[model samples]
Target: MREFLIFSRTARTGGKINPKNLFQEGRLDIIRDFIVEAFFTANKKRSAIVHCFLYGQPNPPLHLTITSSAPVSIDRVKTATLLSDLISKKKKIRGCEMKKESIIEFLTKASKTKTIYLLDKKGKSIHETKILPNAIFCFADHLGFPRKEFKRISTISAETISLGKQTYFAYQALMLLQYFLDEKGID
Candidate 1:
């Protein structure tokens, strides 16, 4: 299984937010791309799970999980719209999980079997890191992780990995990771 856990430091936590205000809430612009890449990569042979951590509201920290097996809408606009609705409802769409939850809650459960890696520019090259079974790659949103969260992640034994020397957008990093997997024959 392949999982992409995205921590959005500026996304609204509750489901009552206005859908049209996602940009105002934060740059949710790349969110769909991240979701799409997670589902389509690795020759479409692996199961994908995208856990979006929204932490931009008063409630703070909403966990939205999207699984690849769920019946996805083909239209990009429809897909995004549906996701926005799900966020507004604070409810699951299809089989995805959309609810209020803490970052630690999700991480604790995910780290049990999956080898978690934190994406960082100062870390070792991702190519050098061994891809263990049931890998879970984590990345923060546009604002990136807070200082305290990064420290907590390190304590959890989540290795910090980088995509070469250059810093790329989160979606680009995901695509690069998929390409690397293809090159390394890791699938």
Candidate 2:
């Protein structure tokens, strides 16, 4: 399955955006559509959609976002380190309490210049590709036909798998936020 990752941002003047309410009852479909349109316009690629869920307080932190791309190698190490470090700081995701401001500050610094790597199960590189700010592309269909039997085209087969798009997109958005916060500092 083709995959992609997206990073989302709250509108500049607004408070934090909560992904949990994205499709609740009203509103966010509009917001999501706008973002999708903007994404396509910016990247010029056909990408599946994913949603994000942000968490925290006094401006909830970004908890999760739907994503489509494979996880970056750097992310695995960073996430593990962050969780462990939080333990030393006496902050916890499940049991203990964490200072929202401090956690945000930490994330902002830890998430910049992260790299994206896609590899096979055997751990071979797929493309060594990295996503620049905003990139997009669409799939292309077959271009040629058989010489003698046009019916042979009907025998051609395609396989499809459902790759949870919203979840992937959300994850990507958070990762991007992670990178951005790490670089620019949160408001």
Best by lDDT: 1
Taking the tens digit of each residue's C-alpha lDDT, what string does model 2 give over 65-154?
A: 223231211233333333233323433333223333322233233234322222112222222333343222111112111232222212
Q: lDDT of candidate 1?
A: 0.73
Candidate 1 per-residue lDDT, tens place, 1-187, comes to 6678888887765545444545664655566667777776433434678888877766677788888766544444555666677677754568677777787777777789778888889988876888776777888776788999888876664688888888788888888987887688764
True-structure RMSD, every candidate: 2.5, 19.3
- TM-score (C-alpha) between model 2 and the true structure: 0.22
State the C-alpha lDDT per candidate.
0.73, 0.28
What's the count of clashing pairs in each model shown?
1, 31
> Model 1: residues >4 Å from true position, as ranges?
15-21, 41-46, 90-92
